[model samples]
Target chain A: MKWLRKDLEKYVQAKEYVDTVIIPVQMFQVVDENQLEKDSFDSEVLAIFANEIEKELSGRVMLAPAYTYVKGADLGREAERLNEWIKHLKQQPFKHIFVLTLDMQWKKSEASLDANLLWLPGLKPTNLQSQEAVQVIRGQIEQISELIRSYW
Target chain B: MAAGLLAPMIRFAIDPVLQSQEKSGDLVNVNLSVDDITDTPQRVDWEVQQVDGWYESNINRTAWVYKDENGEIVALSPICTHLGCFVSWEGSEDYPNEFYCPCHDGRYYKDGTNVPGTPPLRPLDVYEHAVENGMLYLGEPKPREGA
Candidate 1:
């Protein structure tokens, strides 16, 4: 939260304007039913985390509903899915959409997840830190602010 | 003295005539302005930005910039040390983050590091860059040492 506050402060100082935020939640089912039961705890934590992000970015930013499932899709198909979501958000008249991917698995294939988001119109992509995804999210917010300023 | 003087006069007289006959065509000098050579980035940026997908074409025989999602930044030469041809970036949609050469399908990172599977023994070349005010300046392309 300290890092998030710091990044937000920097964005405000930089006078960056953010319109919409896209938060993607990890929704994968484990093989173990016991693990699945425990995974509910993870989901609850993710829900709370999303709530915090929405609350923090409110008024200044609109929150897109979380992307619930993204586990078993080809990279191209995943990109298409993300594009659909961005199209949906564009209809809302939002100028910028921030996408948050909660992907813990760090593989070369997984890196394409962000690249897929780049295919979306006006969607600026960034990664979430394992320990502090919120801070990384805020840094992207600042970056988007800078991009908007460049246009003005 | 007589023979030497005669030889010199004969050679001087015939040299120009022979040279004129040997000339293939008229040689013309071309003067290029600095602006003409350097103003291409703005034009290329606009043109490439409008295009879709990755382009592996060469510019000025020195370097080619892969126009992916990062806009119009110039990339190093595509010629692999092991073999030569253009290298494509993000060739396989599955591994879309790396630069790949189609010949042997040599792979490289965005920063030009070569991957293990490829025949490329070296990394890609990097172009020098400078920005003056709003304009971007790219330096001459050079081969990547140990690449």
Candidate 2:
């Protein structure tokens, strides 16, 4: 489900049926001049993958808006903030909260974070419209969707 | 004072008669072509602008239209008789050529009759339909007897 007014209305009525929330934790920081291209490409790939996962299991899953952070931001504070978001979402009594991210920095702060952090390997900047890129993304979506279902 | 109190109660009792009554429906014109529908049930989604006095709304409608055994036009409601979830036309390995509801694995035959042992005890509802100049127009959905 999208993060829009219309969808939020539907979510309110079907909150119990939709128990899982997928949050894309995107990192917008570029450490150096050379890292700029990679950071943007990685974020795009994460969005593509997360969007596909949401589409596959849309009936029971809610796609929360992405949580973005700079590379040099305080990890401890960000973790706390993320937890606050999760706590608020729990008012809906969500059973599963997954933070899908491409940033490995979250790995160190995972212990304090309330949501489950799933860090995936970042991909090189490739043409997303190409058949190879789409095929790879689709494969990952199928695997991730199956993993999420296993939790239920 | 007693007549004043009794008069309000009497007015409440006769309120139905004093109020004007009317039956109205927002029948929409769906642009689906009748020729496109065949023995194979096809899923069609249409939208209609519903107007009720002062309130105006647009709603989406779904139906599976096809020809029955005698080649009569049939438009079946896409809703599952169990819980109102949208059902899709089955073209799969398990349930081939039937209406399948993913919510509870409910299945309905080509004739909109629910298969035995499914959660849906009643057959799928049928849509009131009419054809004009090759276009199929759908109306209110009414319940049908259980298969």
Candidate 3:
């Protein structure tokens, strides 16, 4: 992970480029009772993954702290948690912030729920096998970049 | 005798200051030593020997690195030509490789060129680089044409 950070700086220095940070949020599904014997996703595991990502993006990109929630759980609680997270991010020095839902169902469609959340920012509703999710994420990045440019 | 002695004393007192000022005009040569660059799956940091003006000034040099849709390493400058604000790598969660500026919302590609219809009519700057003895040396950055 440290090496990744170093590589990022190298590339930035070598090419003289700047960029916003990308943070991925993952929602883990609890294993069924019959499948409990198999490996299951947990918040701790997600934290470890987030930590690794933070290391890789240390200097080149800002890694937002990861928030883990249960899949198919209480929508109200999920929305509350997300709103709180966005509020917290607003205090940071980041130029732009994003929220990757990580295959969760919060059911809140309106972007204005939390006026401070910066317009739902971006969402990664699912982690399906198709690369559609990646493309969606990419498109959003392009749009945001354009928006930033319009001001310049 | 007192006046003659005072004249010699005045000349002696001024000679060293004049000599010191002349010496100050000499040019000092600076040699910058290059250091090795290491890479990892996430981020990258490096250390190199100091050079002239390196410690006293903020260097505006920056670079963008990301894997394209094909997963190739794409590196470019992060400077926005519109106002020179450093652009972020990811503006929205949906766009990972797109360069974004929060100051004015300027947008650029992974290659550091501005997107059409955007405020930035030019691309980001680029730094010259070379690998020597397993070390990477970055030269000064040059603004992209029309940027």
Candidate 4:
């Protein structure tokens, strides 16, 4: 479900069903012009994937705010921080925790991290407005969403 | 000094006239062509741009528009009369093109009529709509007692 007013009200009232949280892990890279374009595209692709997946699993899934931090930050430390946040959020009794990311650095902390990490490769810079590009993006998202649903 | 006094008096004179003319039952341009609606009840989510004086707001709304058996256009509200939850259109093998409410298992017919034994206390609300310049414009939804 989306992080909207209506969903939140229903979520609190019917806490049992809303047991899954999708935490988006995005990297911030603003300074380097070369990497900046890649970062922006990745963020867009990540958002589309999140929204599409949430739409499919609306009644049970809650899309959490992005767990954003600067690129090249200590992966081990970030994993600990992410775990602590997830640990606290477990008070809500979220049965499943899926970390959605495009960063490859999470591979090191994959075993230690307390959530299921679905790390995707970075997207190539493309014109989002073109019909061909949209289809390609949707097709990729569809495959990933099915993978996410298998865990459910 | 004289001009200042006259301006306030003129403004006060027109204030009541303007206050009495607060618009109601505004029609929003839904941006759908007449051909877009088919025999199948298609639910379309639209953004309504509302201008309330200096404040502007965009609100999301949902409506089901279809061509009825008699070829008349019918539009219904998505709100379930039972508990205000949004209802879904499910055409199962047993029930064809039925409006199903997930909240209480309430069921409604394609014509927005509630099945007599169902949980919905009233029929689905219908939006006041008109077609102008080949574009559909929908207005406020008016509730109806079940037939």
lDDT of 2 by residue, A1-152 (tens): 66879777877876666778999999886567788999899999899878777765665678899998887799899998999999988988789999999889889999998988888888778897776886688678767876887787
What are the per-residue Cα lDDT tens digits for candidate 3 across B7-120?
867866866333333344231111222221112112222223445543643222345534446643334555566645556667546556667766445677667778878777
Residue B7, candidate 3: Cα error in Å is 51
> Which model, 1 or 4, shows the larger DockQ?
4
Q: Mark the 10 consecutive residues where model 4 chain B has the least summed lDDT.
A: B16-25
TM-score of chain B of each: 0.48, 0.75, 0.52, 0.74
B87, model 2: CA deviation in Å?
10
Model 1 stretches astray by more than 4 angstroms: A1-18, A105-152, B1-147
Supply the DockQ value of model 1: 0.01
Model 2 per-residue lDDT tens digits across residues B40-101: 88867677778977889765577888888897788888777765555778833499888876
TM-score of chain B of 3: 0.52
DockQ of each: 0.01, 0.05, 0.03, 0.06
Better of 3 and 4 by DockQ: 4
Error of 2 at B45 (Å): 19
Report the Cα lDDT for residue B147, model 2.
Answer: 75
> Model 4, residue B1: displacement in angstroms?
46
Docking quality class, candidate 3: incorrect
Q: In candidate 4, which residue ranges exceed 4 Å CA deviation?
A: A1-9, A48-58, A104-111, A119-152, B1-31, B43-47, B50-64, B76-88, B91-96, B99-128, B139-147
Please, what are the lDDT tens digits per residue for candidate 1 over residues B1-147? 899879857866865333332331321111222233331221121111122247653222334444335443443654544444445456546567676654345687766778866666678876544333434344434567553
Candidates ranked by TM-score: 4, 2, 3, 1
TM-score of 3: 0.33
Candidate 4 per-residue lDDT over residues A12-114, each given as its tens digit: 8767766789899988878888788888889898887777666645666788988998988998889999998789778898988999998888977899888
lDDT, candidate 2, at B96: 89
